[model samples]
Target: MNNNLHIITADTVREILDQYPLELYEIIKNSYILHDQQGSINAPSSFLFFPHRPESRIIALPAAIKPNQEKFNEISGIKWIASYPNNKLKHMPRASAIIILNHPDTGFPMVCMEGSLISATRTALSGIVGAEYLYNKDKSCKSLGLVGNGFIAKHIVKYLFLLGWKIENIHLYDKFSSSVEDFRQYIQSFGDLKITIHDSVSTLIESCSLIAFTTTEKIPYLNDHNLFKHKPCILHISLRDISPDIILDSINVVDDSEHILAANTSVHLAYERNKKDASFITATIGQVVQQKQTIPKNKTIVYSPMGLGILDLSVSQFVYDKVKKQDLKNIENFFPS
Candidate 1:
């Protein structure tokens, strides 16, 4: 057995990603294309719900990608992630995770790394990739709206800046005032982007051309289709925030139909409401990215990405490759020989 396993800490992952931000859009783009080409195996994530605290749950995602023309190395990994919405009261992050990568040929564990940053970054990049194809790039969207002011929302804003989206205003709405204020202070470091705190979701929805939902709602909440005045491109990052009627009224896109439809998400609710019909989902993001489906221009485009494990593997592999070239310390004796 090869004794070359490396343990990557959360601080290391954070430092590497912060220092050398890769072209995540492209990395995620290739991953989606690989997914569309049937070059990847992604098992549906297994969820362990807390009986005492019903809103909190842990999820295990396992996936592998076969080597193809675009990517030469075979990669297989799994991410164990947990989300506790009430963790914010204790001033801790809501989500915590770890990813494990194994040698594709030998099945020996090769790398184990912190995965919360990977999770957030990959999820944010997914939103940006979807927005790239679905939103009208020719038209200038000055205002962006964020429905939740949390860790995932912060990463999404970071990626939006990295992608060079010209936003003149940011409208933020959060249940907690402190969360909104903290997020506001964080974004101020980037530039003098106008940031407004909205009193209600309806106001924020009406104010921005691009809206992202990053809350921890397990059930449907945002249902009013009439509030969307701009035919906004909605990034449904948190899957279950928007109601079924809103889904039916829009042009819906998802990362994977099967995965997103399984967890009582807005799409799943819509499917159940319509008597097990899936016509509400217009196309997968891969199909849109590959130009297999025509992007509609006149309707609200809702993108719901189920947070695939392939993305976690891709980013983890990239970080591992980059970190190997650096002078960083890793856990040498993660396992006994």
Candidate 2:
């Protein structure tokens, strides 16, 4: 074993990504394209469930990037992340994680870094890029609704502002008013539009052509198909928010078919309900980005990405190289000879 392992803290990840949101967006785009070309290998994300604590789960996402991607080094890694829905009540984040990058050839673990920031950042940028291919700005940006105002929603909103997406208003619908207050103040720093907090998801759904679901719902609670009758563009950031029937009715696009199909997500439910008929999902974000597949203009478009592991690896590669040059802390003799 011949490798030194570097440790990247959340503050470091935040500091670096805050300065370069657009660059990270580009990295995610390239990664999707690389994935679309089949230049990457993404294994199914395995989960550690606490049956006693049904609301919490720890997920392990392992993936690799091939040398074909010119912008990033050929590397492989896994992000181990835990999500506890009640953590916010304890005044802590709901999700926490760390990513480990391995030497692509030697298979030595080269870096261990805080992953919650990277996970959220990559997740946000992926949603933005995924929606970029689907939504017509004039049509979809009517109000920009958010279902959950947790950390994920905050990152998505921040990138939307920093990346220069024009918006006239932002309508929010969250279970807790306390959650909205902090999110509302955060929006002020980025400049403001009409910030309305609707009393219900249905009202918010009716008000915006573009809506993002960022909740921690494990099961399908919103089964109302009529809510999306306006044919809105929904960035289903939280995978299991919509009901299976809704998934069946809408035109869906996921990051990867194999990955999302098995996760018991809405689409997965639809897939099972319809007896393995996956015609409802029109394309992966990769195919959409490559212009190989096109989505119809007059239907509800649900871009439900199950948070591909390959994405984490790609962004981790970029972050590792950037911070590797800086004087960050590292674990010496990490790989024993």
**Model 2, 215-284: lDDT tens per residue?**
9888888888788899999999998999999889889999988888876788899899999988888999
lDDT for 285 (candidate 2): 91
Give the per-residue lDDT of model 1 (tens digit) for 69-148.
Answer: 47736989899999998898888899999999999888878888999999999999888888778885553468889999
| Per-model TM-score on C-alpha atoms | 0.95, 0.97
Report lDDT (Cα) of residue 101, candidate 2.
90
Highest TM-score: which candidate?
Answer: 2
User: Residue 237 of candidate 2: its Cα lDDT?
Assistant: 90
On the 0 to 100 scale, the lDDT of residue 81 in model 1 is 96
Those runs of model 1 whose alpha carbons end farther than 4 Å from true positions after fitting are 138-140, 327-337
**Considering only N, C-alpha and C atoms within 3 Å, which residue pairs clash in candidate 1?**
none
Clashing pairs in 2: none
